[model samples]
Target: MTSRFERGVTYAILALFTVTSLTPVLGILSTAFGRQSSLDTGFSLPDGLNWGNFADAWSRAHFGTYLMNSVLVTAAVVTATCVLAVLAAYAFAVMRFPGSTVLFYLFLAGLTLPQEALIVPLYFDLRHWGLTDTYWALILPQTAQSLAFAVFWMRAYFRGSPRAVIEAARIDGASSWTTLWRILVPMGRPAISTMVVIVFMWTWNEFLLALVMVSDEAHRTVPLGLAFFQGQHSSDTVLLAAASVLIALPVVIVYVLLQRRFIEGMLSGATKE
Candidate 1:
């Protein structure tokens, strides 16, 4: 029982927020193609699109190397996070053991600890172990952070899974791992895919971890690489815009491809069959 006025107000609010979000994106798009002589912050209707900015930015910023590094780190982190989260979440959601609840909550606590609070201590610890300035530095910390949230998110879905189905799998002579892989995993594809996409985006966009951990130019992630590029190319607005887009494109492409699965996963958790 909704009234027209309330519905209209809701639509109006949504539209307002949508435009607010798109405004900055459009501004970046405009600035990416804008001439070097221009100084405006927003998009100009009259300014022609300049495609060369992307090529210029790529060559100038050494984005190819940085992009590859980001891909490697993101892939490793996402893979590790997904694997670890699935196993950890499954145990928390289905298995009963002494101290399991306490251990699970400990993992959840990681979600509350901001990177800023942890980065300084993390740096010294990694340095003591000689892990800093290496790809392992970037991959390991990001995976741990992503795992904390991934386990929390995925445990909800796994907990909602049918106990009857789990019992059936066990009765059929399936071991715990077999039941997980053959039954639970297949049933949880939507949730797993969603986890993968989200972890990929977070790991790719991660900056502070990369910045403090990786002092070497060769080990830098895309966000850290983009920061350095922005530092030197601060005067070239168009190039900076182009670099931003380049750094962001892979994530955009991934989301676009998996958007359908993501939506289904979100809705899956809401509706039980």
Candidate 2:
């Protein structure tokens, strides 16, 4: 029932957005490849593809260490958030227990509290426990920050799942654990994949928490490392662009790998039955 004109309009809008987004990325790439002496900035083609800039940035900035730290922290935060969110969401969506509503609402309350409001107290508590300057300092706080949204996301998916299917699982004498892992979890792949992608990006890009929690250079995440790198190489646009690309590459790769599932999940509304 859609008219051709509307479809054309939609495609035109999408194309415009695509170009707008890609322009900055293309500009960075151009600058990243430019000669060290060249002063060209945004959107200008490089004199040549100077691949050495990447090598220089990687070595001089010690991006390898920072990248590894980010990987560890992001992986831990995503895994913990997803696993805990799934369990908590399942319980909230399916299980009836005392104070379930109150408990779920409390979890939801976490979504309302900004990280800035909690970071100071959180840093003190972690320091008191001797967790500062460690992976736990990054992983624990990001995991907690991500949990509220994760729980909310998964709970909607679980709650909207067909009641008849759940009843059939129960009729087959399947335990709740078995039903969740063997049945619902498999069916929820798209939703879970979406959550994984989102949490991974958030944790990978987190700066303030990393800055406030960890002071050791060994524990600096990519964003924090990039900030310091920027300070030192403020005038070296080529090197700076290269470092920015390095920091952003993993996120791009992850999204590309999961693009199909991500699109499916987005299109299939979170609360769709």
Candidate 3:
């Protein structure tokens, strides 16, 4: 009974904290639906609806092009990174081979390197290869950067997965590819969904790669485009909020949709066999 009481108290505290955290986000959401003058006094509900704010911001910021570029780059990075990371992580977690530990550690070492440290060299390397100002520039670097963490994330889950189940799949005549895709992949959803959410969020919000590697306005991702948008609409708080909401909506939506898997992945380590 005491433990149950304690659990109830804990949940109440967490619920309060969640509401507190979301207050700022709710404020910004309300701002997105109002006018610039609405903010001068304090936070409040829009007198009515102001859908034009979104239209104006979208039109003025040329967010259509920016959104397209973001979608393309993020989609490429997420797909390539997931495929490569899952393959590499499965080998690390399941296979026995020469120097696996060393290779794994080398991949892990990439986690320590900062993007700022690599940008200058990366810029030069891309320029030398004439890949600068191209979608490949954004796609490739983000994919590479994301792969390190994705491998790490997937490796933990894969290592914890049921060894008996894996053996059964192999004994049932499943090839390596068949076993991985047909058996282990379905069981690893929580981890995969978590990785997808993280990679999508990171790739969507990435600024430095877009700023340095993409020169053309047509190639600008939403975040970089938002920077220019902010510069132009510095005084229009309503428009800025709306623009931010538009840029951020996809990430929020993705998280909301995959939230169950994300939470499960986070809590999945303790029951490992």
Candidate 4:
């Protein structure tokens, strides 16, 4: 039913988008496996593939340690953010309190506040608390930073939930905590999953806080490690690309796994009708 012109335009747009999205990824992959002599040239498919780059990157960067640290930090952050966000969101959404709206707005203000703006104060605060150079420094502050957005997101989802179910649960003698854990949480899984993915991505990619907080080599996250790799040697392009791919692997995997739930949550949140 489509006209030729319309079909051509559609194809053009599709190709543009495909190229835009895949260009960097493909470039990275190609460089990761391509020969070292081609470093200065713009990305293209290599004539011969080299698997040695991955092995060299793995050993040179101590990416195994970095990966472990990243996983640990990410896991801790997601778990803490979910628990705190869910509880705070449930309170804000379901409970009645004086100045609750004002307080919630105060939390919402955190979304507008840039991390760069708070870096100086946060540095001193962490040092004062003797949390610097430790996992707690990174974990605690990151949790605090992520809480505002998490609460806002979760509260929106909770607010959109059916009130009748909550009322019925209350009438059935379900306690507040019981209702939240048993009823609201189960229903809000999609939203929670979306938040989890987003938070994981942000935390995984976070660099500044990780740089400021952890002085030790062993505690450096993937981003910091990648930055180090990029700066280590100008000629090490293949290894650099391999490291980049490894850095992005977890995010790609997680997104592929939960993309359905993420889309459902986003649609549910954005559409009122």
> Which candidate should be chosen as best, given lDDT against the real structure?
2
* Candidate that beats the other on TM-score, 1 or 2, i.e. the better one: 2
Per-residue accuracy of model 3 over 1-273 as CA lDDT, tens digit each = 479889999999999999999888888778888865665422688886789989999999999999999999999999999999999999999988999999999999989999999999999999999999999999999999999999998888788889998899889988889888998888888889889999999999999999999989989999999999889888888999899989999998999999998888778741245
- Tens digits of lDDT, candidate 4, 1-273: 999999999999999999999988888888888877665434877768788878888888989999999999999999999999999988999999899999899989989999999988998998998888888878888888899999999999888888888899999999999999998898887899899999999999999999888888989988998888788855677778888888999999999999998888888882122
The weakest ten consecutive residues by lDDT in model 1 span 264-273
Top-TM-score candidate index? 2
**Rank by TM-score (best first):** 2, 1, 3, 4
TM-score of each: 0.94, 0.97, 0.93, 0.93
Query: Higher lDDT: candidate 1 or 3?
Result: 3
- What tens digits encode model 1's per-residue C-alpha lDDT throughout 109-228? 998998899999999999999999899898888888888889998898878888899899888889999988898888888888888888999999998888888888888887998899
Backbone Cα, N, C clashes tallied per candidate: 0, 0, 0, 0
Residues 1-273, candidate 2: write the lDDT tens digits. Answer: 889999999999999999998999999999999998888988888878899999999999999999999998888899999899999999999999999999999999999999999999999999999999999998888888899999999999999899898999999999999989999999989999899999999999899999898788999988999999999999999999999999999999999999888888878865557
Error of 4 at 78 (Å): 0.7
For all predictions, the C-alpha RMSD in Å is: 1.7, 1.1, 1.9, 2.2
Where does the lowest 10-residue lDDT sum fall in candidate 4?
A: 264-273
Window of ten residues with lowest summed lDDT in model 2: 264-273
